[model samples]
Target: MNPAAPVHAIVLAGGRATRMGGVDKPAVVVGGRRMLDTALDAVNDCARIVVVGPRRSDLDSTVLQTQETPPGAGPVAGVAAGLAVLDAEPGDRVILLASDLPFAEPTMVEALAAAVQDADTVFAVDESGRLQFLLSAWRIGALTDRVRSLGSTVNQPMKALVPETFDTVLFRGVTDCDTPEDVERARGRAAASPVSIAEARRAILEVVPPLPPRSATLGTSLGATLAERLLAAEALPRIAVSAMDGYAVAGNGPWVLRDDIRYAGSSDELELADGEAARIATGAHLPSGATAVVRDEFAVVTNTSDGPQLSRSQDAPVRDDARRRGEDWHEGYRLAVEGTAVTPALVSAAASAEVTTAGVRGPVRAHVAVTGDEIRREGPLRRGQTRDALGPVLPQFLSWCGVRTVADTHLRDTSDSFDELFREVRQPDLIVIVGATGGGAADQLRAALDRAKARIVVGRVQCRPGGSQVTALLPDGRVVLGLPGNPYAAVATLLITVPSIVAALTGRTPAPRQLARIANASEVSGDATRILPAVPQPDGTWRVDPGIRTAHLAGIIDREALALVPAGAADGDLAELVPLPR
Candidate 1:
């Protein structure tokens, strides 16, 4: 690689530092200097450089500090985020270095960029010959192409992006600060704890709950939870009803069969004289003088001088097929629980119980905005622009979670764009914001919330693809959840948080997560619980899709459940599964 060839360096600085007891590894002082500064010195000659993490004053004013879509999303994610900030073309040279290498030297990077002249990528091997993927140099085009080929697994280990057949080179002597002995001496006392996924959810729900109960028309009660018990106004089977297509007999055994037929909900009831039978349909009200209903299959008809007569078949017993009054529900009997979901079957039950209206926990009216300046609402994207994926899917998703979406809009990345949305936020109990929650210079949602004096109910969670979500409660009795711009992250956070919010507002508890046996093992990322896309197998086990990434949605379109695998869960563990939007 020629020194004259444009080069960009990406310094991944977002380690959660769990091994070091939750310190900021990049900011840790080693040899009287921050480890990140040591790493940055190695690539000082690069045409441009980007550091992926929170804004740090220790960085050179010229160095770019941007955050991964959801901060603390691991090295691969930081690499991608750093790449996005570079604005480099395919043929440009890039050096990927981690911030934890306290002793990294500039000569190592010079050797890497020089070695990459013969290969598309050159990874530095450690003294022990172990590949240090984070300490590498690559042609920007080649690296991105390989990343695209890796599909949604791009966020996985760097090994995942290896081209099956390609040219590569190896340089040696790049050491990382991972030894327990080295960690013991250099660990700092920073208490920058990453919020756990559970903690974030609990905090957000603690501040947000369901709105008051409201009357809903029976026809429009779908998807709402009942705020009050559905009691029966009239006894089920108000009249003796036929349970099957049969004849209503007036006496025991042999009877006269008449042609007069009685169908369900008929205006009048006919009298069945002694030894006579009346034809009746299933669910039909029995005639006033009828005794028991003998099914059509159980009756044996015979021609007689009086009329067509019937008797119980010798093979079939003479039993009544009648539904007795109040067998299903008596007058004033509880038809449904207070928190019962108003499914189609339940609504039908309400209709049968003569319920014309219901007391239901009303949905929180929501306004959705998918924000980004580089986001193109329509037409093919050009250069850095991307298609908006979160807006179209959210309306349907919120409906499933019992939220009524009142409006939808797209916002550009601007200082006042967030302020405008907040100013117009009315009627809705929630204003859902996508993007603009992280450390990007263009991220204005956070500043806007601060300007409005909104109380942040939840901050960054420790979960991958969803850590950047922020929930805030406004003074105007409304709340909003700021989600990551990436479609996968937005979706992951949406599924986990929305249900809990709905349950809180409606005075009902969310349905417990379904526990399914995990069919495969997944590498635990961090201390937080991970939500992986999964398909529930016919055998009641969940097939986890570990291949999903924060930016891609390829295999996830067909996924039904997201397995909430615990931090140290093993294969065959019964993991809790949350439902995805259908």
Candidate 2:
């Protein structure tokens, strides 16, 4: 990070002080320091400074002073004039701050610059959702281009000057000194970097995205988190039933047989009267007024002159064998709580409870595509051509990761195809593109990202088999994860990035990883973390399965896990076993 390249601040101090009763607001002192100097101090760490307005002796001498195209034109003109004299290179961050925000903290400026990671602009958003245009950070190149394109509209509102299609980062620390009350209120307010693979996972899980809660049918709710408690639609076992095949008898044993059997689907035909018993199958309703049940194996039915009689054996015990209504769950019973993952078992219970629908978090749709000119389907292997491994495999992996795929496509290595995918998928949670992620001759993911202006959050993973993994965030908050074209590398990176993506959408805290001790020692290289495929042993240890290659994923076929061996780690060391897909 070139501190020189990160931020170049432009202080818009040219606004006519009509709001301040014609006073030179930037020169006005606050907290025993000049407001202009206070603003300068806020961005003191920046490489260059351009204070747009009339120069003041009280202001810091280090800042360059410039006037709007027509002096005193609005803040937009001030921005244009600042850009005219702004000493910044392409990709440098441009911070636009007002000299009158006496309360603006220097740390806020740094934070804004840092947040310009996956966004074109990172500006202050007041609690009321108002855009604090002046107190914002922007890409120097994007801002410059937008300003130059404004032409005659350079003096229009700041909103008009900003690019229409750009991502914004909201900062809560941008209260202005437009009024004395605003100044007083701002003074009362107070304010308070990259990650490892585990650190990345933790950071992602910390994010609770804004996927709305939706009512989904039980069939479609699997793997989604329940957004509300699941109430029993009716109840499990809505009617009382026999828990086992037995004779429903009333009073003591030696009861007369009713001469009829009750099956599971049929209601009891005869309620047992005193000294009478009826045979009932499992799950069949116990006859009303029945007292006890004698197991068929433990009871005797004998033919007598006055109808058959049922009696318990000498040592046979009589017990109630009926399942009462709502025994498993009563009507309106809370079967599953909010935030619970809708598992198959949970769905089974829901079905038993007669629930047709559940309130669940909306499915996070991942639109997947594989990029590579050499990747072909429905063909035998040819020179420089590989099979379409990702199209068949990634969707299944995505399902296990709790992401639903709406489309799976295979495309050539071109920016047009990549950009078209972005244009096509409307508001997807994730866009997973396989292949062309590294800096190889045929790699086109990097160029596509540049063309789309995608902000790279996890630029690359420092892990073996997939060190070129890229996770970028689009302007719309959608994430784009580029996995290496190599099948092994793609699968390796997918195991790491996909779960993090899922956690980000669901806000699920990842369980702490337990290290797997490897028995046989293996030598490794590289400063990046190594993702070694391993087979878990019966004793909770990992047997390193070491033959992984870029062109093939055969090593991962029978492997149970991908172990994280950090840099400088030796043999016999316990490495973290990455959570497997699903």
Candidate 3:
């Protein structure tokens, strides 16, 4: 490749595949070639390729795999390592590809590269409009600066880097292969077309289920559908009591003219005779047989021996404030509608309409297991050791979807201890392990999960930053999620996977909301869904504010929302924003 046009592609392939019987995953055969080979083939035509992983000797491509900076640092570190390698060639951009992506398309790479002419980074978008981060392209300089400032730590999720600081481009095509099942699925789909519209549609339908029937009183998230929790109350008749300081009367018959009157108080014993009148306060009841009410200001008061008598002023007309029966309530009145998101106004309306408790399904609970020898509470850090940063934020992220952490415990990443921990936290709606998911002596999360007597459904997702994520459904109705130990990858996993599971469990679908604006240029290569962190601007647009990738707790505290940069976006793409539920 020409030196000036040295746009190198970095393929991340260092994840340990404990679910694949603890074998080398990138070397696994897919489409008659090693997974790495397939990924290189997809990108070789785009630019010079660099492989990022622990062992590059096994890879067939001519690309160089630099030992990960801050060994076992995480996906952000892996990206940083790749960027560091490409740093030698100033002005040269780096296109990132995950080795497990068997369904990557060259068109996406071209699109992303084309988009970078105007933006800082270009990311790929899947057919469903989600951004694919791993399969992305970035300018070497900015990415390197972000990595250096953020630090390449396992706890710092790479998505947290996305904020208003980076400009992004969205493209289509960066499907990744995270697990055996994902590889199989991609193979099955690849046999058809790289970007098969039909396959994309089918995948979307399979991933997102139809909404369940809702009640009229259910509130809605900003961009989510409203529940019909208050609809049942529509059958009841409603009366609109004056919401202001005004009088109520019937607008029938000529206004009665009277001078002497009795003030109706709480004493129900006081009754009005036919053609009689009374003086009433703002909320006082009108006298019987009185058809209209004349304001005290419009009335001429004459003091008499008995009491003050009232008569309408010469130029003032008698005003009528009537409360017609059933005026507010009528047949065919819609108390609420389907797909309408709940808001304060909706809640107030439901309350005014006398809606009682609303029926709502609770969110699905997910169990998280953090395993490591170095894990410690956040406090004074020992030299060469740090605290478990992801511990605090992970729970908060889950809580937003109403999914509570059933159990959280730290264990040594040993097969035996992991087995015990898994057994203890098992039976939750979902089980997530933070560390030891990758291949290493201490990385035993996937191994322990598989060894359990529970039926394990292990597979990887096709995307960047979190491609190594492993998910399984245990035989005992528990979902196990194994995340990379790196802080950045862990956070990304939570952002991408936890939300979906929570939405599934709580019946709250993940919907996009306008949270913030992108401040800098950030783009992805081919089509791949990418999620990033951002700070919300005063005007409601999210500014891409990068966060440290090593500390999960720190990142969460600093960032307000997750900005989703879609695949195939260019410099000025309007990425979808999902506010971190607090």
TM-score of every model versus the real structure: 0.64, 0.64, 0.51
Task: Give residue 405's error in model 2 in angstroms.
Answer: 2.7
Give candidate 1 regions above 4 Å deviation: 1-193, 522-525, 536-540
RMSD of 1: 20.2
Better of 1 and 2 by lDDT: 1
Best by TM-score: 1
lDDT of 3 by residue, 12-67 (tens): 87755656665767776544346777678777775567677876555555667685
- Give the C-alpha miss distance for residue 318 in model 2, angstroms: 3.9
lDDT of 1 by residue, 1-582 (tens): 455678789998885677777677777654334678778888999889999888887667889889876766666777777878898988889999988876688888888888787778888776576777888889898888876675553347778766654343454534566554564333221102245665555555555656778899866867677899999899988878999998998978688888999999898748888888888999998898888999988888999898798899999975789998888889899988887777788889888999978888765678999888787778998999887766887888788777889899998877898777878777887888989888889888878987987766665777777777888777786888888888888878888888777776666666876788887745543466787898877887778876677775665789888877877777778777878876
Clashing pairs in 2: 435-485
Please say which candidate is ahead in TM-score: 1 or 2: 1
Q: Which ten residues in a row have the lowest lDDT in candidate 3?
A: 193-202
Q: Which regions in candidate 3 have their CA more than 4 angstroms from the true location?
A: 1-230, 234-240, 250-359, 378-385, 416-427, 448-458, 462-464, 513-519, 522-530, 535-548, 552-560, 566-569
Tens digit of per-residue lDDT, candidate 2, span 314-405: 78765677777887878999987777777798898888888878777756788888887888877698899877866887888888777888
